[model samples]
Target: MDAIFNYLDNMFAHLPKTEEVVRAKNELGQMMEDKYNQLRAEGCSDNEAVGQVISEFGNLSELAEELGISNQYQSASSEDKFVSVTAAEGEAFIEKTKKAANKIGTGIAAILLGVISIIFFSGYAEGTFSPTLGGGEPNKIYIAVGLGLLFILVAFAVYLFVMTGITTEKYEIFEKKMVKLDPHYKLIIQEAKENHRPVLTRKISIGVGLILLAVAALAVSGILSEDNEALLISLVCVLLATVGVSVWLFLSGGMIQSAYDKLLNEGDYTLERRKSESVVQRWASPYWSLVVVVYLAWSFITADWSKSWIIWPISGVSFGLISTIIHAATSSKQ
Candidate 1:
C-alpha cells in the first residue's frame, strides 16, 4: 500500500498542471497512504502489504485510464467532477433551447408561406405579379424554399438533440467513475443537492444561450427590421434571457463564491460542508416567475393569428411557471 501510495503521489506530482485531475489523484493518494498506515499498524511487512494493496487495486493503469489521465503521469483533474453543477442542467436546458429554436423556425416559415400565398392571391386578383419576380407567379418557388429552410432547421435540431444525449451519457459515466474514486461521493452529491448553485448556473447559461440564439431566429423572421412586430417579440426574448441570468447570478453567486473561497483557502477537497438548495431557489423563484409572465404576455400579443400560433408562448410560460413553482415547493420541503 505504501508503494502504491508513493507511486500515485509521484504520478500526480509529474502530471501536467490541471487542478482537478491533480486534486483527485492527491485525494486517492491520501486514501492509499492512510490505508497503508492502518495495515502497517497491524504488523504487515512493507512488501506483503504493498503486494496485497496492489492486488486489491487491480491495476494502476486501469485507474489512470478511468480517471482520464492520458499519460498516467499527466494532469487532467478538472475532468473528474462534472465541470460544474450546471453541466447536467445545461444539457436539459440546451435540449429545450433546441426545441424552442425549431418551433420559432417553423413558425417563421409558416408565416412567410402564408404571407407569400396572400401576396400571390392579391397579385392574381389584380392584373400581374410583383416586380420582384418579373410579374411571374413566384409563390410556389417561395413556398418550396421556405419549406426547405424549415426542414433543414428541423434536421439541425434533431442533430443537436442526438448530440446532447451522447454528451449526457459521457458525463454520466464520468460522474460514476468520480464517485468510485471518492469515498465521500455520497456526501458530495448531497452537498450538490443542497448547494443548487450548479443547477442555477445551468439555467442561467441556457437562458443566455437561448437569447443569443434567438438573434439568428429574429434575423430570419425580419424582427431585426425597425418597428416590426417580430422585433418586439425578439426584444422580449432578449429581455427574458437577460433578466433570468441576472436573477440567477444574484441568487447563486454570493453563496457559491463564498463556498468556493473556503475551498480555495483549505487547499483540499472535503465533502463535509453542506448548504440548502431551498435557500437559493426561494430567492430566485419570484424573479424567474416575473420574467416568465412577461415573456408569455409578449408571445400572446405578437404571434400571428392567421397561423393560429397564439398558444406557443402561453404554453411555454405556463410550463416554466409550473416548473419553477414545483422546484420552489420541493426545495422548501428539503
Candidate 2:
C-alpha cells in the first residue's frame, strides 16, 4: 500500500500541480487502492497485489492522455529529478540518526566529564590518593591519575564518534542529493517530530537553565567562599559538569530534529537551500575538520577544558555566518 502511494507521488512529483492534476492524482490513488484490495481478497499476497496493481496502472505519464492531463505531464518533463524515499529507508534513516545522536551525546558528555575528573583529582581531592594506591609519600599522584583517566575517557569518546560516522555513512546520499519523502511517510515523520517536539523544547530550556545555574553557583561560591579553596574547586567542577549535561541535551535533541528536517526538506535542507548551499557545503567538510584539529590542539596544549569547549559554540556560530555570506555572494553572482 505504501509502495503504491510512493509510486504515485513520484509519478506526479514533477507536474505543475494544477487543479486537474491534483484531482487526477487523488482519483488514481483511489482506483489503485481499490484494485489492490480486490487482488488481496482474491488471495494475492501483499507484494503480489501491489505489483499487479502497479503493472496494470502503469505510470502517470502513460495514463496522462487517458486521464486528460497530458499537458501537465508533457510540460513537467524538463523538471529536475527528486529522489523518493521508501518507508523502510525513511524508518531506517530516522532510527540510525537517533542512535547516532545518543552516541554523539554520550561522547560529548564523556569529554566534558573527563575534563572535570582532572579538576576533581588535582583540585580539592589533591593528595587524596597515595602514589601507588599503597602507603607512599602522598604527592599529587592523583593529578597523574586524573590525566590518565582523562585520556582514557577521551579515547572512548573518540571511538563512539567514529562508530557513529560508520553507521550513518550509508545515509550520506540523502544529504548529498535532493530527496522527497512520500506523503504517507511525511505524515509519519511529521507526527513523530511533533510528538518529540515538546520533549526537545523542554530539554533545551532546562539545559540552558542548568548552564546558567552552574555559572551562578560558581560566582556565588567565588564571592562568598573566597577563603574556602575546597568549596571553590567543587563549585567550578559543578559548573563544568552542569555545562556538560546541558550540552549533551542540546546535541541529542538537535540531532533528532535535524533528521526530520532533512527528510521533510524544511529548515536548512529545503530544495532551494540545498541547491544554493551545494557549493557552501563543500566548504563545510574541511571547515569542521579544522575545528576538530583546533579543538584537540587547544585542549591538549593548554589542558584547559574549561575554556577549550567555548571554541565549539563560537566556531558553530561563526561558520553559520560565514556560510550564509558565501551563499549570498555566490547566489548574487548568478
Point to the candidate with the largest lDDT. Answer: 2
Q: Candidate 2 lDDT, tens digit per residue, 1-334?
A: 8888987886688777777878888999999999999999999998778777776775556767766777765654546445679889988898999899889889988877887787677652333233334334463576678778889999999999999999999898777566766555566676788898998999999999998888798788889877776676677678777877887899788888888888877776776677677878788889999998998798678755445756866897899899889878866776
Top candidate, metric TM-score: 2
lDDT per residue for candidate 1 within 80-185, as digits (tens), equals 5323334344335334434444444444444334333333333333223334544445555654553455446445555654664554454343222222222122
Tell me each candidate's TM-score.
Answer: 0.30, 0.68
TM-score of 1: 0.30
lDDT of 2: 0.78
Candidate 1 error regions (>4 Å):
1-137, 173-313, 331-334
